[model samples]
Target: MATPILAQPDVDSGLRPVPVTNRNGVLEILRMRRDPFSFADEKRLRFGEVSGMNALGIRMVTCSGPEAANEILMNKDRAFANAPAWSYFIGPFFNRGVMLLDFDEHRHHRHILQQAFTPKVLKGYMDEMQPMIAERMTRFPTGKVLMLSEFKQLTLDVALEVFLGLELPKPEADRLNKAFIETVRAGVAFVRKPVPGGRWWKGVRSRKILEDFFYEHIPAKRAEQTPDLFSVLCHAESDDGDRFTDEDVVNHMIFVLMAAHDTSTITMSQMAYHMAKHPEWQQRAREESLALGEHLTYDDLASMEAIDLIMKESLRMCPPVPAQPRMAIKDTQVQGFFIPKGTMVVVPQMANHRRRDIFSHPDMFDPERFSADRAEDKAHRMAWMPFGGGVHKCIGLYFGQMEIKTIMHHLLRGYEWSVPADYVMPMDYSALPVPKDKLPVTMRRR
Candidate 1:
């Protein structure tokens, strides 16, 4: 037997009830974690567009397909809130970050935060990080290496120096990186309590580490002007002269660091795997990078169209933060399916990116599809939303893109690598998509 997700609906609204599975969604949580795309597709086929399930003791409406995604993300009616839903998973760890705010408050904070990401600010960041990136790239070993871990370390290095304006010793950097990893992994941990040595406990303890670091440094950042993110956030203000308090700066700093580092790592790892598998594309992108000279300038970042295409295609295939979560704040309807207030909603961008009706050869790794001649992603407005959509779309998109392009630019100029043609890198869908076997590559200097 199935229960209506809406339980009951207003007759005049003329909306149908969302179909929810009778089985416990909490039980399906593990199965879905194993492969969320397959699970999403299965439910969509069986129950139609708006499928409902209870996961981790919360009832959620999965807004699969383009229409549902459009309605939810566009949020025309302002019926959704990001805080309650995200907080359910990452609340304590990332509390009150920009993504966690709503409506007026969200808009205000975004306005102030926008100051840190302007064209001039981004140029400063690009200039600052290029040398940091180049210095790290110069140290790559000349044999088989775990590309994912390597990228993770590089991105962490970039974030700590470029974001915090601090160059800590190896141990401190490693400690900060470990704290970030624990806090992120804790969000999805099955055990929520602070049991001894448990994920939640580790995350709670790590949160203190992060808070202490940022809180300790906020005073110095506020006292001076620097090009790093910490200084920018400390000084950035809206037209109304409103700026972030020390607490606000610390919260935003922690959240932004995770977002920037994790997403860049995932994107780089996916691109590396793709490049290793398809050396022809690698060769092509390499040529483009070589043409631009050894060190990339702010303007040269856009010239590497080959790298840009590959990045877009890689992001499409293995989107970081694949599913965007929100909760209905008021009675809302998505594509004629009624959603009761308080029901959690998920926009499955990774699954949506592969829709047959939208993307041709959705599973194929063809970068040309994004080229001007093809423009397959243009089929629908929400067709290629790896960064999400509407007002809550990622704020750091420009900075993140520049960082990836800069790193890839350096990588192509200095080295080349490959993986066996027969190999298929397995992905762990449990958390953010990471290669189960840290992708191994045979590398040598160009």
Candidate 2:
């Protein structure tokens, strides 16, 4: 019988190996779930300095600085791959979507996905989105407290209709929302199984329900050729004459819906929080939006500079996707350490964005950091990557920016809002970072 040979632990000087004395991985998993950022923070503090070569049971390296993140993400041979871990977490649902594909397959899918995000397409999307924004804003209760959970729901509704041309009924939306929430929760679940009553089980069920719903609509949409994301995808063809199969369309549709809705909803809620905290900024945004008038054209969206700045700053403070995970495809060296193949490399956006060396008063929310004169984000091109960088950077960046700006333009112009002085922002970093309490605030007409 041969004894299992553990790799030599490469702890840096003055740093100790994270004690894995406890047999069950439950405590570590719980820490990861309860407060992921804090867990990372603790590791950094305790390890006089930590090395990616030797971190925990996973044999992982976590990079927090801008330079290190850039190296890992921008590598040309595609030395790093997203498939390993992404397949572990999101694969069951989003299998073969652009994000999960790598190399040539990734490039091929990206080309097709790019067509749906053309400037002309986005202009049309804005046309459909404005009325939805205006209608949802009109429904907000004045002088009464409202939970941003409701706001997230409204944005999800808009995202579904605008992106997929599906107007989800209230009951169906509610059920889907629960399923989505559970699916996100399951991403970090300790016990990764489809056993009864487990998060994974619920998520598996949720994915099926969504897949079934979307799959049914593809044929009808293909026949009609409606002018929406679904219709475009069904009809879209690659340069080689390749087209998405019905399953491909369904998976991509689910991916787009989650990407567009979840991130935008969190970002909108954060923007609203900032607005409530800073009445002057909120007022300025409102004034700017009002100047653009009630009926906002695509051209009008470009002129909402102040609103853009506010949203950018809010995202800087609380990015929707706080961390990105990649896997080492071959043994590689990063930051002077040898990271073995199969190691998980985490480039945490939240941690990197908070580096004082990159931004003055990194903790403070200041949109001026992005101003032409300061251009603090230019300190390092990769320093301000909220939507990620490299070939895998968000394909929907332009569309997302347009959707968020459009929503802000309408809401700010039509309403006044405030967060209670005691309001606290609680973050859950399980999947996308979102406010734990859903950001309740009071609203009234300006």
Candidate 3:
């Protein structure tokens, strides 16, 4: 009988093997789930760029640093697939999302999705968001509050209005928000089955809430033209005449809304934390926002250089999606390592973002490192890829950035927030890196 390649326990000629200490894949998986950034950093320091483990009987290869990231993400040979790998973890919930499609199909879906995010469309989204942001800011709680929680609700509301064109009452809105939360948190469940009462179970149940709503509204959206993305997508078609089906619209909306709202929440809350820890930077950013007045335009966002720098640094320190995964569709070598077919290849985004060789004083919260004189991110094209890179890069990147900046502009003008000088955000690494405590800050009206 032929031996399975990964079970051979020997490194192929010119191909590096997983460290001998990494024999227990279950332990490795647990350690990674507990502290992914630490696990990746330790592996890179001890094993260099490429490493792997046979976790729960699956051969998983993990790579660190921008060079490894470039090879896998670039995927010039089309030798790796995004859908199969992502489907294993998040596919049941976010099935058929742009992030889950690959090759020609991915290109096709992306082409159609692009029409909904054109500069003009994005400008419309911004205009829609401005008044909503202002009205919502009027309700922001004062004094000590859980910042991550606040930001989460803020971004979700923005997503519901701008992306879905829904204006539900408080209770209905809250119900949908709860469903989305369950749906997202369920993706990282260690248990994969629909066991009753499990995370996966709840996720499956909540997915119906979102699906039924979108499916019900598709007809109306298709019949009318509105500024909201839901309406635009219904009427949007590729130049080649390809249009999204009802299923495609629902899948893309569920996935895109999750990506937009959740990532923005993490980025905004972390930026606030970074500012609290370093008030001088906060003051600098606030000054820029103040100069722009009560409400700022999307184009005006770029002129607030300090806010942009702070936002970039925050994303660098803690990207919303810390790691991206791909599976080898066929036997492939990424930077001299032989990746066998079916091996799950993982890209460690945060580990590379914090590599000392890549960013000097990588642990510090110095936004100036990204300034013109330094440009540390220029060290490598993929060094600070918070939104990722390649054709599979985030399709809503600009709109998401615009939304985050708009929210920041309002928060800066409406309130002043802080935490203890020596405090640090103790983060949860289970799904996304969120503060375990939900991040508390002493927020006061400015």
Candidate 4:
């Protein structure tokens, strides 16, 4: 038998770059800030499949569709790195967060972090989460309400209680929430500096406050064994006896807390948008929640299939992290496109989610597509990567899901809500995707 020769990549040539007339990404940023979906769709059409653009002083090769996203996210060849690329946007603010680590360091950190999210620990979190969600649901005012703002506060409170073991006073919690908001907003700032009253300035100050807060609490957490995540981080060790330093604990805590609450808030708001828009799904989910009980057990969460499918649909429509950024550590090929070393690459999940080839009626709000009968998500492994994929996939995904479902479960049982028939949610993607107007709904007791 004769051995076949492998074709060599044309490293001398570069990607088919997208023509960008906007210097410094001013026009691109305006388009993305205006309507990210439209901007992505336009890119897909203009660039065909693989293309490059220079934005914010970064030269990025944007890979569209599931195949390219799978190639970049799965990291099969090890040619891409996450940290260096993410640092361009968020490194200064969320420096050394696990998502900003790559290769062995990422694996090491993730191993130590996994101890905090074990099955038993997650159950305890759910146990605490149930009552908090129920209590929060009970307080939602009847009639018109902004569900996004309400959900944001509710999720932040849950995160503080379950993750940090803190029952902050209303004023303190609000202050911390604002701090997180500023820190997150900093990732999208064009100036990337601490000019007075600017996003970067606010974020720098917020990072200091969060650092002080976590550092102050580290000593207390280390002195005792508590079920909270902060306590777990203070004590968690890898199988090899690797553990976090004081700075490591503080850095990880700040990142995890922001990830937990902010992403969960966005997901819940999307869930509310879908539930309120489609009353049939709402009724089905409400029945499931009511039948189970007022408080959800860990097992109950698994069996809530209707809510699960709705959650999947919501994520498919509006993934919290819409785009994944990575840098080419070495020369590579993505779908026959030559990617040179040091080029920033974006795998746009929001664009991939709308690919007509993968999803039937891609823009429609059809939860049944995720049902076992349809199993549309099975079309491609990368088709619905809201939580991302491979080694760097989100560790807290299950907890986030539990938190969102727990809140939705309580909301469904306690209230019936609806948006106007003609309503369309105006999504703002300044940082994470959120309803711009906070998702107004006509909420009332059941």
Candidate 5:
């Protein structure tokens, strides 16, 4: 037989290849799981914008900085896919979810989903969330407590009531929470199989639980015109008169629930942590909230500029979804590096947000960087993409921001919280980036 020609590596073409010291990429994966931002920064410094890694037995490229990020996320050439790559991490659990769909299908589903997130729909969601947020804030424990744990429960409750329109009994709610947690945990499992009692196994099992829950409710949701997201999704129609099938509603519900609650929990945790760390900013936000009165209208929520700044800084520091993953559906070159077809690509959101060439003090927590005077995020169109970019950008962006801001507004009005001066909450990257210790803080009435 004739010799098979091997593709030339980027290093051979004068582009820096990602320095993979480990043969199997296991060590790098572990380091990345431990501290993704640090790992990305180290690689960027050593390898520049485009670098290659042998991860999960695949040649994966990490794209950092605005230019490379825009190239991959924009995907103008239709050379990349979201589903196949994300499937490697989360596809089994979140199958056929909007984020996992690609090309025309992704656009179609997104258009349908957009009906559930229009301005009128979001205003209703905010209305539902405000009272729930206030009621939940009243129940928070005083003194030293794990705010991350509390925020997780709070956001999940908001998601349950506002998104599902279900006042499920405590036992059922707890069971559902466990299922969601397991499903999320499975996405990052190295095992990636349904071995009994394994992370992936649990995830697979949990996915069934979630599917059953949504599937059971689909008939009712389709029959009624409730204001909850689940109901809206069931009845929502695209401008072209397209609607989701039963399976589509369930799949999308599971994915949206996971995305909405888990990510909001992370954002709230970061805001709470940073507010506790910097009392001045907290006070500024609190004063802004006070000006809006105890009951918030949609207009009131919009007027909290200080809270917006702090939230922006919090998102920049710790984006809920740290990295956006993609797969090169066709061979493509990005930033002078050749990416072979079927190669995995990552738009490192966390690393990109902290690029010093883009931000003045990349490591420091400074909300003022977003001020009109500074406007550092304007340095590049993609410089501060916590919600991601391109055609597959988060569909629930406005809903999420409203949720975060509303929750923070209530927290500020009702309580004062603090952490020890030197405390640093280590983040767990098993699924989403969350406080490993659950982010404890001392809380009391304001």
Candidate 6:
């Protein structure tokens, strides 16, 4: 026999029994993890609206509509908390990094971190990055085939140079790159444990190796201030005269590396794939890039409005961080339902970005939607959240954009690329959705 559907309860009672069936037992939770997106879709269809489910002994709610998502993510004080659930996945590796902090503590750390991303800082960063980009892109086989996996390596090298101030030797960089890949794979491992022979164990080991390497170099960097992000961060101080400890610096460095490198790599690959599929857009972007002449300056970055629109559209279609999860610190009410304390709330950017009401013809890869005439994303303040929203929104968003554009500009001018005609998109829901096969492509000089 089917479990009888319950009636919606009164809001005034403070314990409103909504029509949602509680199907969130241990088994169901495990099943959901097997395929998170399909699981979310199933829940949405059955419930007639998204609601909470108890999965893995945690009260979890998967929200879909714009209003519900905005309320939970934006209303930080009353509806949700960032630290509780995020810590479970990222805490072990990152350890009190800004992404895991909330409330006043979040604000304090963000203020200091913001210094590394200022206009003057970005100009310095670009100056440091241009030659690196030129050097790395030159290594690509001019008229030969390539895969995103290979390109991802190139981007990772750029990130190391820009973010960490460490220009890894090719051999050493390759070794660390392999370890980093394994480490990222471990983040989404279903059995989240560091037992022998586990991905988590490998990831934990890789993290230690990275930390030790960065720690050893910090003293030299501090002695002679360099024009790298690590140097800037090492000496940065809070408004209250507080300074980051050695551990703080290492943890934050690891966090920034993982966050910036992986997200940019995925996003850039997606951008390239889209650009290839739509040749006209690629030509337009190339023209936009060439308009600024041979050298790309800070002002030139701001001027490439067409590239910005295309990048925005790519992110909208395929966000690197598809879902943002939060846990309730205390019992709270959302849209008339009493959410119990400790419940895990998910605001899926994938779902929000594809919302039919907010975006017309949502599935189509149309950059024009972001153009001045269309401006579809402006429908809601929280509608287009590729970088997320609210207090915990990604701090490196602008920098990431600048980096992607800079890379795209150089590549569009230097090379022409194509992928297999039947290449299908694959989603890896673990850490973030990356193409399973590393997205194969062929390239030639333009």
- What TM-score does candidate 4 reach? 0.95
Point out the higher-scoring one by lDDT: 1 or 6: 1
lDDT of 4 by residue, 315-404 (tens): 999899989999999978788777778888888887788888999999999999999999999999999999998898999999999888
Q: State the C-alpha lDDT per candidate.
A: 0.89, 0.76, 0.86, 0.86, 0.86, 0.77
Best by lDDT: 1
lDDT of 4: 0.86
- Tally clashes: model 2: 1
> What is the clash count for each candidate, in the order shown?
0, 1, 0, 0, 1, 1
Identify the superior model by TM-score, candidate 1 or candidate 2. Answer: 1
- Cα lDDT, model 4, residue 422: 97
**Candidate 3: 10-residue stretch with minimal lDDT:** 1-10
For model 1, give the 10-residue run with minimal summed lDDT.
Answer: 1-10
Tens-digit lDDT track for model 2 on 1-446? 32221133355533233222222345654665577657666756654223343323465566667877888889765779987867767777666777888878888888988889998988888889888888887877776655467667877787778877888778988887776777666666556789899888888888888888888888888898766899999999988889988988888887788777788888888888888888888888888988888888888877887888888888888788887788888866556555667877778787777777788998787887888899888988788998999998999988888888887887887778887787777876666777777777777786
Clashes of 6: 1
Q: Please give, for residues 1-446, the per-residue lDDT of candidate 6 as tens digits.
A: 44322334445666654344555465665655456656666777776444766545456776776776788888755557777788766666666778888888888888888888899998898998887887777777755454567667877877788877786788888876776777677756657888988888888888777778889988986777777888888888887878777877777787787788888988887888888788789989888887776678777887898789889999998898878888878777566566667777778777678777889988789999998898999998888998888888899888888788888888887888876677666655556777766766778887
In candidate 1, what are the lDDT values of residues 1-446, reduced to their tens digit?
Answer: 54556457888889888888877667777878788778878887888777888777777888887778888888989999888989988888888989999889999999999888999999999989998898889998779899889999999999988899998999999999999999998898888889989888988999999999999998899999999999999999888788899999999999999999999999999999999999999999999988888878889977789999999999999899989999999888888888888899999898888888888888899999999999988888888998989899999999999999999888988999998889999998877889999898999998
Better of 1 and 2 by lDDT: 1
Model 5: lDDT to the true structure: 0.86
lDDT by residue (tens digit), candidate 5, 49-111: 776767666777787888888998999999999998999998889999999999989989998
Best by TM-score: 1
In candidate 6, list every pair of residues with a backbone clash. 24-54
- The per-residue C-alpha lDDT of model 6 at residue 155 equals 71
